[model samples]
Structure formats: C-alpha cells, structure tokens
Target: MNEVFDYVVIGAGSAGCVLAGRLSEDGQHQVCVLEAGGTDATPLVQCPAGLAAMSKATHLNWAMQTVPQAGLNGRCGYQPRGKVLGGSSSVNAMIYLRGQPQDYDGWAAQGNPGWAWADVKPWFLKAEHNERGADAWHGQGGPLNVADLQQPNSLSQDFVEAGVQAGFARNTDFNGGSQEGVGLYQVTQKNGERWSAAKAYLTPHWGRRNLQVRTGAQVLRIVLTTTKAGLRATGVEYVRGGVRHTVHARREVLLSAGALLSPQILMLSGIGPAAHLREVGVQPVHDLPGVGHNLHDHLDALLVADAPQLTQSFGWSATGLMHMVQGAWEWHSKRTGRLTTNFAEAGAFLKSSPEVSRPDLQLHFVVAKLIDHGRQTVWGHGFSCHVCVLRPQSRGTVRLRSADPLTLPLIDPNFLAVEDDLQRTVRGVQMARRILAQAALARHGAQELPHSACAQTPGEIAQWVRQTADTIYHPVGTCRMGHGAMDVVDSQLRVHRVLGLRVVDASIFPSIPSGNTNAPTIMVAEKAACMVLSHAEKTSVAAD
Candidate 1:
C-alpha cells in the first residue's frame, strides 16, 4: 500500500502549485502534487523568450496534436502542453492578463455563482505584486511578480498606433478599469526572468513540512471507497519513473491537471459520458454527460511583414542563429537586453461587434517578422501581428482513445466550427489589416504578408478565417462548469457526480476569458484555495 495524502493534486500546473502551496501552509494537511513530467529545472524555462525554444522540446511537453481541423484547411493543429512541474505556465508566453470584468459576469449568468467580476476581483488584487505598485484594480502584496518590459520595442509602438488609426481605443492597461484599447503587455516576470508557478508559488515553500511535491509521478486514477451514505475519493494510484505505486488521499482529490488531462483522468476513473466510458473499457461511475463537451481554443495565424530596421525578427536569419546564441548568453549572465522582452510585446483587446457587450478579439504585435514558418526569415527585417477571436461560439469535445492513463487523450478544439467564431476571426483579420495600413506602419514599409486574406467580401474573409486561422494557444471549457444538464461542474467547480473532487484550472472556465488566461487562471486557483480551505476547516471542526 502506498502512503496516503490529505490532498492529492493531480497536475502541478498553474492551479496545482497554488493549491499545494496554500493548502500545506496550515501544517496539518499533507499535500501530494503528482506531475507526469519532471521538475522545471531547464535553463530556458527561466528565460522569457525561452518559451519559443521550449515549444519544440517534445520531451518536456505532452505535445498533443488536434485532429485535422476543417477550419485550418485540413491541417492537424498542434497543441503543446507543458509536461513538467510548473505546467504550461512554465512554457507559456508569460503575458499576464486578467481578461475583462464582463467575462466573469457572463460566467455568473451561466450559473457559476460567486464568480462574477466583482466577486472574484479581490483574488486578482490579492495575488499580484505588480511593478507598477498597487492600484484600485491591481495588487501590491501578492505572490506573483508582474511587470512591464524595461525596453519597450518601437515596433510595439507602431502596432499600437496602427490599431488606433484603425479606430481602436488606446487604453494602456487591460487589467485596469476598462479593457477596450491597445498597449504593451505586462508579463509574469521577476527582474527579467520568467516567474513560473514554481518560481512564484512552489519554490518559496519547497522545504515546508506538509507539502510533498513529486515530479515524474504519473497519477493513474482516483481510487474510491463507499460507505452507506455515498462514494468518497479515498486515494490515488500513481506510477513514478518505472515503479508503480499507490498514494491514498484521506480527505479530497483535487484535479488541477489543466483542461485536457483533467477530464481524461475523470473518465478513466469512470466519471464521464456514459457511452463513451463503456466504449473505452471503463465502467461508468457517474453519468456526467458534459465531462468533455465544451472544447474551444482561440485561433491566430501569423501576419508577417518585412521590417524597416534590424528587429529581433527571427524571421530573417539564414545566419542570425549565432545572434540568438549570443543573446541567450547575455540573458543568462545578466538578465537584460534583447532576451528581456517577451516577443509580441504589444497587444490589444477589441469588440468584434458593438452589439456584443465584451471584447471578442485579441491581438499581439511581434517585432521579429519573417516569411515561411519562421524558418525563411527575410534578411532585411520584418514584423508580425497575431490576432485571435477571444470568444469562440463553436464547441468541441475531448474523448479518450483508450482507458490507459499513460496515453494522451484525443483532443479536438473544433476551431472555427461556429459561424460567429469564424466571423469574428475574419473581423480580427480585417482590424489587423487596417492597423498595418496605417500611416505609422506605412513609414516602415509595412507590406502585408502573402497569407493575409485581402478579400473584400465578408464571406470571403470568413472563409479565409476558416482556412488559415490557427490556435493562439488558449483552450478552455472541456470539463465545463455551468447550469445546463450537460455541465460537468457546478458553480463551486465541484464535479456533478462526484464528492470531494474539484477542478481548479482553466479547464473549469465556462468559456475562455476575453484576454490572456494566465493571470485569470491564477485567480481561479486563489478562489479555489479559499473554498477548499474553508471546507477543510469545517471538516476539522466537525471531527472535533
């Protein structure tokens, strides 16, 4: 028999780390964090731009690919998930955005009570220590370190000006009072290094008595036992390295393995779509029909251009690989210069339609521009703007290929499946084109890339959105939380058919937040930690 834990957090991604850190602070509960991959001890995992290099490292990533998306000209889209300690936060762009207030209210309307913008606002303020100091909306005393780039790129300025010229309101801060505007992004960084979940939450408490962090430990399934009353999650069975072991949870099993894997683990433990579970050779423990139904991801394709001067555009190097190496050296020795910037420094949030109350599209401007898959960089110089429709109307599903816990689940985001998702994407492209056409960018000879759809008819633009759009890497709502019968989790984020199990990641989001999801994800964890701690305290009082 393996050891038992009070709390077994499945994945040590953004949410798991926070949960583990906060839950163990009381010195009473023993928290075991099961990460499928190893520790985030890589050299690049700390560098801001290391995300691009790390993206190609499949060994450190689960690296799941989607089924051929009809929306992207039948291309099987790529979805890279961090398999290591800090999870995707370790590998993501590190851009810190909380989305808009309306995004939360929309959740409340969908039946996730106590989760409106105002309700969750405190968590955002409570978890941040921004370089800009405290404000009405931002925090000053928080675990996470957020800051602006020391050297704002000139390309970022032009991109903002272009958007303004295109009639976008230039609001500098999205996380502030309003979000409809253009500006440079604040990132999850310290000094200039990446502030991954480990750096922010876990590392500070590594040697704590109650926190047991296990890397390279794959949790096979949640084990349950039953009394006369109902079912209870008693523990978890996991495998580490090559050895199979079982670790029991005496209190609760928290699944923070992110959107893709969390739902998969649920089904493997027999808590998903009934028919689907039986087909995959798992007896249905619960008939939660919405375990993996609401699959959505923001799609953005590169709009490349030749730059005026020598920008960091990885787009132009038959020979600049040396520069990248030298730059990495400079960053490692002293965290400054080119390596400090998280490429795509500039960004904006815009409403695709005035009728829509919240912003539907997001864009980020990158300094380096090149042609052809970032391989054939134009030597002269170039820039690219990535635009994504934040709220996708189309939904998809994630189903298990088999019952094996070791295998990756089959994921289909169904990108652009809904007409509005496609329509908004087309609008996003139009808005971007308008930005590029501005006189500011015109000074830089902003020639649009070949792939940018030049179609005048909205129908043609929509078709291009379907054909060329790609995931901007924000996927959510698989184990959807809401009021409908198909909803898997309720307002408190508890699974409909299970007791003592909660999903506290981006996966629990009913829809993708209207901006970058990293900061909002942390907020969810903060809220979840409070909810969990309160329950644990209540359970303790009862025992007394």
Candidate 2:
C-alpha cells in the first residue's frame, strides 16, 4: 500500500518549506515534503560564521562543478548547493535583499501577470519579520526574521567608507526606496543565529499531524499517468536507505528542487527536449523544450588585497587564532560577537557605466581574503571584494550526464558568452579597484594581490576577467515562467502540458534579479502558497 498525500513537494528547500507549511495550516490537506539531504540541525548551519566552513562541507553541500566555460578561459567553475533541510538557505551568507523593482516589473512585461513589482512587494513583506520593525517598505509579524549584524568587523565597516569615498552614495537599506549605494547588509538571522527557511517555516510545524517532512529521500522521477485529459503527475519514485519507495499525490506534485536540480529532475522524468531525452536514454513523456534551457547566473570577479596591518580582518595569525577561539565562546555562550558576522558583510550596487539606467554591478566586500569560494586557504591577513553583473545576457543549459538518477547533471552556465557581458565585468572590476584604492581602505596599506594587480589596462582587465570570473551562486531560469514557446511553466506556475504538476522555485524566474536571490525566492513561495490554496478552494467548490 502506497502512502498518499494531498500534495507531494519534491525538495524541502526554500519554496518547499513554505508550501508545506502553508498548505497544511488549515489541516485539510496532507502535505509531504521530500528532501535529498539530511537534517540541518548542526551548529555549522545554525552559526552564521560557519558559512565559511559550510562551503567545503560535502555532506551538507551538493558541491557540483560546471562544464568548462570558454568565456572563463576553459575553467570549470564550482557550484555548491545545500543538501540539507533548508537547502542553500542553510549554508548561504544570509544577506537579505529583494533586488530592484524593475527586475520584477520586467517579469510582468514578459507576460507573467501578477509577478510585477507592485504585486510581489506585498508577498516579500508577508514573508518577512524585520527586527528593525515595520515601515512602508518592510513588514512585521512575519515568519522569517531579519536583523542587523550584532557585531560587524571593523574591516567591513571600512569597506563601506571606501565605497563612499569612491563616489557612491551611502544608502543604509538596499531594499528601501533605492538600491544604489554602499552599506552594511541586513541578514536572515535571529539573535545572531542563522534563521533559515526551515527554521522560519518547517521547524515550527514539526508536530503538525498533516505535514510530513522526509529527509534523505533522493527522488528518481515523477510518476506520470495517462489520464483522460492528458498526462498528469500522479506520484513520485525515490530511494531512501537504499530501498525504493513510491508515494502517491492525490492532488498535485510541486517541484522545488531549485534552479539546477529542478530542471534535471523534470528532464529525468522525460519532460524535457525530446531529442535530448532520447540521447540520454530516458523515454520522453512530454516534450517541454524549455525544461533545461535558458540557464544563466551572476558571474563574479574577485579582487584580493593583502592588508596585514588590519588585525580585525580574518586571516592566519596567532592573534587571529585567539580571536577565533574567543569569538566561538561568545557565540556559544551569549549568541553574539564577531562569530555572528556573515563575512561578506557590506556591499553596494552601482552602474558599470554612466550611461546605464540602473546599477549593473553589485559588490560584496569580505573581511577575509576569500579565494575559490573559501575552499582554498590563504595564509595571511587580507581583504577581498566581489563584483558581479546584476543581469547577464549569456545563457546556458543543464543536460543529463546519463539516465542513472545517482549521476549528476551536466551544468553549463556559459558565462560571458556575450561580448557585452565581458565588457561590463571588466568595468565592474575597475570600479572595485577604485573603491579598494580609496583613502579609507588604502589607509590600512592594502596592496592588490598579484592575481588582480597585473591587470591595469582595459585589455588586461578583460583577459583577467576571463581567467578569474565565476558564479556568486545565483543560478536561475532553467524552467522559466512565461507565455513564450520556450517557457516551461505558466503564470500560475503550472507545468504547461502536464496536469497536477508545478515548479515553485528560483528555476521559474523569467530572469535573474539584480541582487542576492534568497529573498526573492522566498517571496515567490509566499505568493505561490496563496495561489495554491485559492486554486484548491475553487476546485473543492466546483466539485461540491
């Protein structure tokens, strides 16, 4: 006998958590959430500073790599996704941002009604519980807790001063009326601890009888059936503890496995391009050509500098070691101190060129010399800054490596494929250099590392960008929502040709937003929850 659920959500990530939590609120629907990863209860996930270590924790991360990108001079970029209860929200830097209004307005213009900035702003507010209290732009009494860092590193504060000295305004709130300017970032934390989506949504509902969360369940495919109308998703097959199991969904199946895996999961279920499915040995069920197309991400270029005189900056030293131990004690005992800092504490949004209408480049200033996403070790004290294109024109794909569910998918971001992307990246790198050279930062005797110092000219900077640029972990648009021929989902987030199925995550984004994507992803789920419940009510009324 197969266990039945009114709704089966694949992937207990940012969106899945919200869907399950919201759908089961009325106690009328039996919601089951399936997560590929295990628990997110470890201190490594709860402590905000532990993000540096989480990047290299394979068990907590998918740790996938991309196919060689020509735009990156044939370098294979690393992509680390959280394999835990909260998904990437469990292991991210925790910066809370909702991008520019135009980003969502553009989505509405692309034929996705109700996704305009005006429509989505309320959802963002609904999902938020800003500790700074409610305002015209923010909300209170929401689930997710948003607060200022209890203890920000002095170096991070200096970075903000440097940005101001570099000619950019000093705007305090990026999510406020304007996003242009440099300032300290607010994070998704509560009392100096990370407040992931799971903590905000799923954790509180653990005792709910109607909601079931199954971790460590690797879904192989969505079980589809040939119905009287057309193909409909009936259930799903997954493996857990080396045993295969099937679960039935009486109403619908929601795929929220994120931008990369969501598309791969659909394609594995024979829902992608027909030819590609055949090549990969999966029998085609529905020919949705956009299942794995339209992949894009923010390509980031780093500028590292050696600032040995700045003792506040994190690095390898006797004093730094002592500080780390003390900070750990403070965080464990009092839940406050330097250990509460999300290293990329301060950042800014600026135009790469004066002619641009809005900010095209975003900066993340780290209090440590971060290299290779903090996987590689740099021995001395220093600082680093990352500048990424807010909206990239280059597109790519996510194809299957083989039919085996255990096999990872082939991910190609195809970064900088468009010449304009490269030019913008170069301009961003120059701007970052100017900020770092400013008197506020330069006072610490910061010297550019050899990797970035050699690139002085525009030609040299372009080559340097090709050699060094990589993703800042914002990958989206594989199963974009639109009315176009290539769109996989409709405005309501339903799979176009398949009934009783939908994708609710960053994958459905028509295009990438202007800044960190976590906040916008949560907003999408908040709005989707309302839509799902409303649809269920209408269906019940019609049947009655």
Candidate 3:
C-alpha cells in the first residue's frame, strides 16, 4: 500500500504553492506538494537584497546554461532558476506586472476559454494584496503581497526621468490600465522583505493537517495507468535522501515544474513525441508532439556604462563597503534603505515602431554595472540598462539529453533565429541608447563600455545585438495551451489526451505575457485551483 492523497502537486513553485494552499483550504481534502529544492528559510531567500547573492548561489539556483546559441555568435547563455520553495519568485527581481490585457484576450481568441482578460482579471485580483488597497483592477488582503519599493535607487529615478525626457509617458502601475510608460516597479515584497509565493500561500497553511509539503524530494516521473477512458495519471515516483518512494493521488497529479522542467517531466513519464521518447529510451505512453516544441524566452541586450560616482551607484570601493554596512543596519532596524532594492528597480514598456500592435520592447534599469549576468566583475561603479524584446518570433525546444530523470535537460532557446528578431533587438538597443543618452542620465557622464557609442549604423547595431543578446530568464510555452493538434493542454490546463493530469504553470501558456511572468503564474494557479475544486464537486454530485 502507498500513501494516497486527493491531490499531489509536483514542484512547490509559484503555481504549486498556490494550489497546495488553496486546494486544502476546505480542510476535508488531503493535498501533498513535493519540491525538489529545500526550504526557503535562508536569509538569501528572505531579504530583498539577497537577490544579489542569489546570482552566485549555485546550490539554491538551477543555474542552467543553454547550449551555444547560434544567434548569439555561439555564446552560451546563462539561465538562472530558483530551486527552493516559491521557485523563481524567491530569487527573481520581484517586479509584479500582469502584462497587457490584450495578452489574455489573445489567448481566448486562440481557442482558450475562461482565460480572456475579462475572465481572468479576478484571478489576478484574488491572488494579490497590493499595498495601495483594492480597486476594480487591483485587490487587497490576498495571499501575494505587492508593494512599491520602500527606497528606490536614485539612478532608477533618473532612468524614469530620462525616459520621460526621451518622450515616454510616466506610468504608475504596469499592472493597471496600461503597461506603456516608464516608472518604478511594484515588487513582490512586504515591509522590505521578499514576499515569495511560499510566504504568501504556503507559510500560513503549514499547520494544516490535511496539507503536507515535502522538500528536497525530486520527482522522477508521473505514474500513469491505461484505463478504458484513456491514459490517467495515478501517482508520482520521486527520490529523497537517496531513496526512491512513490505517492499515489486519489484524484489528480498536477505538474507545475515550470516551462523547462515541466515538459521534461512529461517526456520522462513517456507522454511526449513517441519517436523522441524512443530515442531517449522511454516507452511511449502517449504521443504529444507539443510537449517541448513551443519553447521561447524574452531575449535581452544590455548596455553597460561607467559611473565614476560611488555615492549614487554601487561599486567595490571602501566607501561602497561602508555604505553597504550602513544599509544593512538600516534594513535590520527599520526594513528600509538600499537593502530593500530588487536591482532592476525601474523599467518601461515601449513600441519600436508605430506598426507594432503593443510594446515590442521592455527595459530593466539596473543600478549596477552588470555584465555576463553579473558573473564578470567590473573594476568600478556604473549602471546597466537591459532592453529585451517583448514577443520574440523565434522558437526553440527543451529535450531530454538522456533517459535518466536526474540528467539535466537540453535547453535551446534558439534566439534571434528569425531575422526580424535581430532587427527588433537592434531597435531596442537603439531605444536604450536614446534613453541613456538623455540629459537626466547624461548628468552622470557615463560612457558605454566594450561597445563604442560611435557605432550607429544598422549593421553595426545588428552585429552588436548578436554579439551580446541573451535571455532575461522568462522561458515559456514548452507545453502550450490550445485546441490544435500540437497543443499540449486545453483551456482548463488538462493534458490534451490524458486524464487526471494537469500542468498548472507557465508551461501551459499559449504565448508568453508582455511583462514579468510571476504575477501571471500565480494567477494561473488560482484559476486552476478553482477548476480542480469545481470538477471535484461535480464528480461528487454524480457519484451520489
């Protein structure tokens, strides 16, 4: 006999934590969530400023790198994912944006019901606890905390002023009526600390007897059965403390392991393309061609500049060290100061051309001289402005490098594969240069690093883009949602040809949203929780 629960959620990530917390709220059902990573108790995960340390914390981060990208001049791109509870929400920059409303409407038009902007806004509201209080568009007293930065870096403000100086409007809320404009980002923080999904959803429910959360438990694959109805997932096989164990689900097994790993788990469970499964030595249970096909991520190019002033910018000088000590003391005492920063504090949404339907480019203004994902250290103080394409045209794949479940999956975000992607990226670089070159930022007298600002030709910009462009860490659509043959899941998030299984994470997104994905992922879990509970109620009524 095996331990059986009403629901077993794989990966206690942004979506998984929400599902575990919401589904077990009735107190009658048993819900179990398994996380591959350990607890989120470390200060590096709790403090907002710990994001800087997280960049190098290999143990806490997946730190997956892509194969050399042909579009990037064969440069290997760094992809960092949080492995601890709350998943990437615990380690990300913490900006909370629901993206453009049309992003959801576009999904509905593409054959997904109940996901349109009008239909899904409530879910977003239901999961948020905005500091500004509730409104028709925003909600308060919800699980996830959304707050304005307690103390934004001065350079961040300068970026906004520069954006305005460069002819862009100032937007107060990216999650509000419109996303177009430059402004300070509202982060997923509460009282200067990082408010990851685990903090909002899982922490409060830890005492619930019906809910069990197992950390450091790596799921190998989903257990499935061939019934008269079709393929139905029954349980999951996982490893903990070097011992293999099995847990059965009485009702459902939800996969919420994110975009890169969700599809990898599906393929490991023998549910992907039959031919590819065979190649990986996996027995085919189902032939879903779209399991890992629609892979995409927001590709970005960065512009690093030299800032001589250590008081306004972050650097490695003795004065900078003293400032850090004082900032730490301030945060420890009042939860305020530089320690509250999420690094990419200010950003914007803008269009490259009038013909573009929505903002095709987004910006992240970092108050530090970031290079190579902060892996390469610079000698002095400066700043970086990252310009990423909003909706990339190129697609890639996440494939099994081997049959072993513990083996890392091959990630190929074949960025800039489309010529237009490169062209648009060049436009984004040009836009960033325009904003950085404005009078507000120009006051710092920052000079471009590595690449000369003198290079202004289209070919020069295009070559520079190819030389430096990489991911902003928003990977999605590996298991896309739709009604088409290649679609992995339907509108309700159920696998197309499987029963009692659902992917309740970003992997199911038909297309990536326009901004940061954490908010949208939380919303997806809220909606999925309702669908699961509704189906259970209907089943009980029929059983009676």
Candidate 4:
C-alpha cells in the first residue's frame, strides 16, 4: 500500500466514488479510495430486476438489524446496507429522485449556508446525464445516467391511473415541475441495465494513474494526531486480508462511510461524546457530542391487495415461474421485457392534511405482495402500495456498541416516538387504501387484504401500522450539517473542531430530504468536491 496520497477517502460508496473520480480529474492529486466490500461485477448488480435476489444476498449486504423498537410492537426492523463498490446504489431499487426544492430551503433555514435549493441544483445537474436530454433542469454528457425504464409492467401504469382517479394530479416528471402527483419513476439505468454510482463515475476512470481504489479494505479507524495546530486526521488504519496497513493523507481525509458507520468511525477516533467514548474504553480526543446524534429515517407501511392474474403479479404459481423463465431469456437477449421492472414503479406524493403546505406522504405502488421487506412470502399473486411519512417528526440515534472497530453499531430509529408521526402514517395508510379502491385498479378484481383492510377507525389503523411499519431503506442525519451544538459538520461539510477532515455522505444530511436519498447524496458529494479542491488550491497558493 502507498504510504501517502493527496487525499484518502474512506468507504467507496456513492459519495466516495464521486469524490475519487472528481478529485483525481485534474491529474495533480493522488487519490486513494478504500472499500470494505468487493467489486460490483455480478449480474445481480448489473440488472434492474436483480434487486429481488440482491436484497437477499447476505454476502453483499451488511444485513444489520435494528434494536427492538418501542414502536412496531417491539419487533426489530431489518437494515440492509450494501457493502460493495457502489454501496447501496448497487443493490437499491435504482429510482432517481432529488427530492423537493423546499427540502433544501429547509436546510438553509436550519443554519446551513449554500445548501438552499438554488445553490444545490447545479450540483445535481453536474453529475447527471439524463436520457431525456439536457434542459434547464437536467444535464447531458455527465457520468450518471438517468433514463426511463425500458419496460414498466401494465400493473404499474394502472397504478398511476388509479392514483389520478383517486383525486391526485398526474405528473409525468417528478424531477421537473412540482412534486405533488402520481407518475412512473425514472431510474438510474443505462439502456436496460442498472447504472450504479461506481458504474457512472469510478468505472469510467479506472485507468486514471492518480486514482487508486482498493476493495476488501475495511477501515479500522481514522488515524488522528494531536499536533499544536489541532487534532488533525492524517490518514486511516485499515485491515485488508487480515493484515493492517496505514495510509496518510497529505491534504485531507474524507469519511464517506455512510450514516451507520461514519459516526462509529468518528467515535472510534475519539471525536464523539466523551462519556460514550470512555464507556467504550476509548480515550477522548475531541468531545464532539453530535457525532452520533440527530439520526432519523423514513418509516413506511404497506397496504397490499390480491391480484389473481399471473401476468400482472409475481407469486408462487407455476404460470408465474414460467413467466419468470421467459422474462430472463428476453432480458438476456434484448435487454427488454418484464425483467426491466424496478418493482416500485408508479407512485404518488400527496399531503396527509390539506392544511399542511407540502406533500407529507409518499407512496410506492408495487406489482407484488411485498411483506417484511420482501423477506416473507405470500401464497398468491397480488400488488402492494407502500405509504411513508415524507417529513417524519420522530428522530433516533446510532451509538457505539463497543470500541471495537469491527463491531456493529446500535441503530435505534425511535420510529413513531412522536405521536404525530404515527398519526401521519395512519393517514397515509388511508390514502393508499383509497387509491387501491379506485375503479382503475379495482377493475383487476384486486381485493385489499382482510387484516389491514378491516381497520376502519383511526385507532385501529394506527395500531395496525405500529405492528407492520418498517424502513423504506432511507436512513440519514446521524452526522448532521449545520452550525448547531448538535451538528457534526458545517455547511462546508468539514467536521467541527477538527482540521484536515470532512464527511461527505448521507451521514451529513442536516435533515432527511422529502424523497429518495440516493440522488441527493450524490449531489452532496458533487458540491463537496468543489469545496475540497478550492481548499487545496488555496493551500498550494499559500505555499508558493
């Protein structure tokens, strides 16, 4: 391993890939990226339909389960994070959403500068290569490919019609115009295959001599030194193939380890709450109490119904299995067919209460009866609609279980801790039922599952949601960006009270955005690249 580099980025996830690619573009900086997992070269990672199989592949997934929630009848929720080159983007549903503009404005209001909607839109465009071509809202010739799904199931189109019939506006583009309607989602796909962050950014730049990407290199801790200037992060100590190695960063160290692991890494480096550090047998280096605070995630509840036709739904029938076999051949040959479906294809963003300003409830219409994050099986063909609170009032935490760098961190989302969060979720469930009951969907002879359908009263619905709701795969804000006492990083994404270090990932979100987090996380990294480069330029000039 190299002893030193201009920049060392931890975790080659969505953010790290962008940083590695962009920072090394000038050919003047040596950038090294470390990933805990291996390459994303399998068909399960390249195909859009492979999400079902990939989600179950334990080797590629962190498979971290949350501590028993006080909500959900004390049932533990499953937390699946990708441990590969592209990180969660490799295994995600591949939906490309940048969230509402007001989400960024909200961040600016919360003490973060240059993160308002107007300020970050260009960053979004900078990293995008939309298939629809560039306009005022999108870009062309960018690394990330955003395109329409090659083949969306008829059931998904029916979902959009059903949503429109249920009194919602029809939106053809969620990224353009307002985000208050029903539509088919545009995915991060190229032609017919999945286009992950690694594929978009890092893959194209693999030949860059200044860039070094090492897989299966798990970072043990950030190597910090207490110099007279401050506690500076010099490099990171990582274990690769059972042997430990250290690589120093001559410029800065970027922590892109994600929400679940970034805080743990910081705490391990003695940069978190002093009491918690001492409890875990680590001496405190920097008493930054907010390292693991402000953790939150989107909790969603599914309302499912039966769809008897094998062609429209996925189930255990012989005919369904036959269709799957045919679909596989079709996709392999022409990259077209039912295999191109991203499952949660059509959806809506609606307000839970008319009095509320923006859409607070987000829905995902699935062509299958998804239960327990698709871990459990249902007997027959059916469809399901996932309803989640867009702006949850509830908050949670990620704390160290021990000082051991390899141990799993304790994740407590504290979902439904706020009564209003449960109330909003109940309203969301009612909305889902209304849309499913619309004639556009009812024509398929789909019947709502008896258990959830029977809950007519608000109390009954709340109780049902509590027993059933779980994560829709968005967890963020553990290492928030702001100027507050609890904020870990500032608007520039630099860790507070520390020099020569920064965190660029979902972990630094000041607050969770109003939609899917992948695109926004990528945007954050794009902007952070400029910040890091500007810092380096100034340093160079000062030295000259």
Residue 212, model 3, lDDT: 97
Number of backbone collisions per candidate: 6, 0, 0, 0
Error of 1 at 49 (Å): 1.1
TM-score of each: 0.95, 0.99, 0.98, 0.98
Best by lDDT: 2
Local accuracy of candidate 3 as per-residue lDDT tens digits, 160-229 = 9999999999998888788899999999999889999999999888999999999999999999998999
lDDT of 2 at 162: 89
Which 10 consecutive positions of candidate 4 have the poorest summed lDDT?
A: 307-316
lDDT (C-alpha) at residue 269 in model 1: 88
Q: How do these models rank on lDDT, best leading?
A: 2, 3, 4, 1
**Candidate 2 Cα lDDT to native:** 0.93
**Which residues of candidate 2, in runs, are more than 4 Å off?**
none
TM-score of 4: 0.98
Checking candidate 2 for backbone clashes, the offending pairs are: none
As a whole number from 0 to 100, the lDDT of residue 536 in candidate 4 is 95
Candidate whose TM-score is highest: 2
Residue 196 alpha-carbon offset, candidate 2, angstroms: 0.5
Query: Tens digits of per-residue lDDT for model 1 on 1-544?
Result: 6687889888999989889988998888899888988878876688787766665677678878888887677887778788888898998888889887878998998888899999999999888999998979889889999999866777788878887887888877778888888888888889878898878889789899888899888888888676665776777888887898888888788999888888898888888889999998999987888988898877885677765454445534644566677777888888876777788789888877789777878888887762332323256567778888887788888889898888888888887777777777777777777788898777876566555546557887776566656667777888888879888878777877577788889888998888778788889999999998899889899999
lDDT of 4: 0.91
